[model samples]
Target: MECAFCTDGIDHCHGTLVVHPDGGFAECTDPGCADLDRIRHGLIIDCHAVDPGCGCVPHGSLGPALRRAS
Candidate 1:
């Protein structure tokens, strides 16, 4: 599935973290977010769970589309 976060902003999903589905993760705890449950919308700040094809993969792994593609 495509991440709306990135879809809303091109290349914005790169290098983000990959967060799993968590029922307790609706706090919008990530910085600069709003009062919304990101997981419910298939999203999490700095985490590309919906777009794993990018750099937001498991830790220590080669980040292909990771981090803004500097």
Candidate 2:
């Protein structure tokens, strides 16, 4: 569920897979590959598939998440 984004110092841009209310996981590739700001705000834009067999979803299907209050 958790991903390390950076190889150096306090890894930046880490991401966690968002599970839907139904228990289905959102599209994701590497956890660390997603944007930090997007992840923080739940606005995941890219698919960081954790499993090699995982497939990507269409950009249109990947809806944006609501931004969280800082």
Can you give the TM-score per candidate against the true fold? 0.20, 0.21
List per-prediction Cα lDDT, in the order shown.
0.38, 0.39
lDDT of 2: 0.39
lDDT of 2 by residue, 1-70 (tens): 4344333344343344443333344533355565433334323433422233224443345445433323
Write the residue-wise lDDT of candidate 1 on 1-70 in tens digits. 9867677773332222333334343334345544353233333343333434334245534323223212
In order of listing, the candidates' clash counts read: 7, 7
Model 1, position 11, has a per-residue lDDT of: 31
Check candidate 2 and list the clashing pairs: 5-32, 28-48, 28-49, 29-47, 29-48, 29-49, 30-48
Please give me the total number of clashing residue pairs in predicted model 2: 7
